[model samples]
Target: MTNIGGAFRRNINRIGADNLSLILALVILVFLITVVSGWAGYDGGDKFFSWQNLMNSVAQAIVIVGLLAIGETVVIVAGGLDISVGSVASIGSVVAASVLVGVGTFGSTLLPTGNVVVAVLAGIIAGMVAGAINGFIVTVLRVNPIIATLGTLAAFAGIAFLLAPDGKPIGVVTQPDFTWLARHRLFTDVGIPDLNGSAWTGIPVLTVIFVIVTIIIHILMAYTDFGRAIYAIGGNEVAARLAGISLTRIRIGMYMISGGVAGLAGVLLTARTTSGNPINGVGLELQAITAVFLGGAATTGGKGTIIGTFLAVILVGVLNNGMNLLGFNTFVQRVALGLLLIGAVAISQWRQVREEKVRARALALQS
Candidate 1:
């Protein structure tokens, strides 16, 4: 028992207390959701716990938010914030759809695949440009991150509406190739006997993309000098500058990355809805920011993990899915998420205080 206890402590220290807490909360929430689902007559919780739902429903549903969270993680880690990502996504979707409809028509007679590539490029580029503008305002113009992004949020959203005809959804149903990202699945013929002996359609392309992006971001943040610079800047801008880290360049790059990812999410959104609805990503920035904070990213910046953010995204997805199954209204769901955000921020502030106290005590002892 002593040995086991020691091993557990070691593991906890390695994984971090914040991450462990998130895991425990996720497990408890799952159990509660299952019990509630059973009581609600959802076939003993199968509605929320089934394999099909996990893979097809929940995984697919979280892709957009997950992507946004990943980008937000980078920005937050670099000592900045971007509340304009959703608006950037909206802009990307509109741009992608418009390009698809226009170029797709012309390319249909020539190179069929060319239009899809062009449309995707246009969307991503639009997002990156929007991000650059945000970075410029914050770094060059000396605007606060919150105010700068908030301004862009409104501006970009309006731009999206203006780009769309009559301020409405641009239908992309006719562009089947463009929507393939949302519809395609791998291994449709693989039968899993353990899963009701049915052929598993494998994972959705969108989910696969999300996983890939997560892995890439994780590597970028964990194993690169660029990532370390970001951490240094977030932890202490003055110290980092003295250490010769270019705050302006790194922060701008981080914002561009965020915008690029948000743009990709926008493209995926267009694929999923088969339309470029200017309002599609209206409130998604809130969810993404929530996930970043809830995943243990410091509100003051300088600390976070891609893995934690990914897990947090899953937790949010599960919570939303379970609530929907239980017939909770959207308004109630929004309130719950708002509460979660508040709790996450509070926890982050507490952690920061504790760390500061520990450091102070150590410095005093050394003196």
Candidate 2:
């Protein structure tokens, strides 16, 4: 009992009070939302906790946000930020959809069907190229990350709009094969029946993809040397550089990964909507950053967990779902999200200050 208690204490110490408080808050919020949802019901149907709704929440609302959040987490942990992920995603969607359908905005066929794979590759490459540009601007030109990415944000979005002028949506909406990327299910009508004849269907393919991505990222962040270097650089760039860590290479690579993932997210968005809307990814960057920070990652960087991010995304999804069920307007929802982002950053900074004070006192006592 003593050993187990000691281990528990050590784990808490490792996580720190801020993260512990955040976790508790998440649990409480989830509990309250679930209880209220059950009590209030949804759209006159007593189905707040239904599996169908859960699946929809994960598949439609959460997956893309989660992916973007994961990429943002990487950059944030590496002591940088990319505010242009949304714009990059938008460009990726426009390009990918245009290529996939082999048509330009004016409905002219630009590529053959045999080039579908190449088209997808082209879209991803476009995103990576944008990321590389951001990286070059920041590392080579020594521009601030926030400013560089912000500039790219506008540039990328403008490019997307230019490609699909007047808010046009590209791609064949009625093509089942193209739409299957988002609509396909891992299982259908294969159910586990109880003695009372109750049964459940299954999860969406997108949800599965999201889960796999999360797991892979969790491992990469937790177990890789590259991850450690990122954290080190975030914690203290000079110290990391002295330790032989290549800041330029690492930072550029981080941005590239961020852009690449955002591109893939754009593709997924196109799949889900069956149309590549140039404005599709607008405001997503804010949501992704909000999720990462809310997950207990510091704005100053060097500390965060993939699990925290995953939970944060789930929390956001639930909040959005709950708000929809409560009949709130989209404007109100946006306000709530903006406030949440500010609050998350405030809480994270406060925790860092508190930890610094504690460490100072400890050092003084030792002296």
Candidate 3:
């Protein structure tokens, strides 16, 4: 019995203080949402989680923001940050919409077939190109990651505006029926029915995409040699370099990965909106950063997990949904999110300090 109890405690410690905090936050938030959701007149069920509205809203936001958070995770794990990702996504949407609809200066009929697959690829490539530019600026010119990405954020958005300088959002009106990309579902109903005896059907297509992306990234970050290199670089650049790790290549590659993933997020965003609004991704960087931080990723880098970020995404989604359902002001939600980030950072720092002290104490005893 003691062995089992000790193992459990050890496992909990291994989860890290920041991660444990997130788990606690998630549990508390869910409880509050469930209890107070009734104040908002939600009638779907006793618990807020039982409400379809809450679930759907969370699902939608998670799919959109989760991908962006994943990209942020990759960058942070490698000791960098990319604020321009939101802009990359914005530009990607613009590029894909323009090409698919054959509108603006690009001319219609570029994809006369309105081929969604082609449009998606175009959007993704646009995002990647933007990311590559960020990588070059930071890795080659040695600009700070934050500064480099911030510059690109403005630049990318400006270019996106140029793509549709008319200031009107590009819709799929002329594009070949690509709306289904966002609308399609998979394994909709393996034969489950609701309490009302209605058939429960397909999960949203984007949700599936989010899951697949999360699983793939989790594997990459947790298992691969590349993942180890990323951690080494983030944890101790000098030692990693001495160990033969190419700092420049790794840094550049990480930014590229960040940008590319952000681009893919843009394609997904385009599908969701069915239009390319240049401003669609505005402020998304903060949201993604907040989620990553809340998920236990340190701003200083070298520590985080895909599962942690994924949970953070869901947590954010639930918070947003619950707040909206409760009729809280939008600014209140923003403030709350900001506070969460601050708290997460504070907790992380505290943990670091505590660990250092523990190490020092052990060394003192040995001496």
Candidate 1, overall lDDT? Answer: 0.88
Candidate 3 deviant stretches above 4 angstroms: 6-20, 36-47, 105-113, 173-177, 195-201
Q: For model 3, what is the alpha-carbon lDDT of residue 300?
A: 71
Please give the ranking of all candidate structures by TM-score, highest first, separated by commas.
Answer: 1, 3, 2
RMSD of each: 3.0, 3.1, 2.8
Task: Give all candidates' CA lDDT scores.
Answer: 0.88, 0.80, 0.79
Error of 1 at 21 (Å): 1.7
Pairs in steric clash, model 1: none
Q: Provide TM-scores for the models.
A: 0.92, 0.89, 0.90
- State the weakest 10-residue window (summed lDDT) of model 1: 103-112
Query: What is the per-residue lDDT of model 1 for residues 1-367, given as tens digits with 9 covering 90 to 100?
Result: 9999999999999898878888998998888788855775664345665657777778899999999999999999887899999999998898888788863322233223338888888788889999999999999999999999999999999998888777878789988898999999887667654454323557899999999999999998999989999999999999999999988898888899899999999999999999988998899999999999999999888999999999999989988987887778899999999999999899999999999999999999999
Candidate 1, residue 151: the lDDT equals 96
lDDT of 3 by residue, 226-324 (tens): 788899988888999999998888777777677777877887777778788898788889889888878877667788888899988988888887777
Residue 133 of model 2 has an lDDT of 88
Candidate 2 structure quality by residue, lDDT tens digits, 46-159: 344566666675456898889889888988998799999999999888888877765665224544442445556666777888888888999999999999999999999999
Preferred candidate (lDDT higher): 2 or 3: 2
lDDT of 3 at 66: 90
Tell me how far the alpha carbon of residue 45 in candidate 2 is from the true structure, in angstroms, after superposition.
9.2
- Full candidate order by lDDT, most accurate first: 1, 2, 3
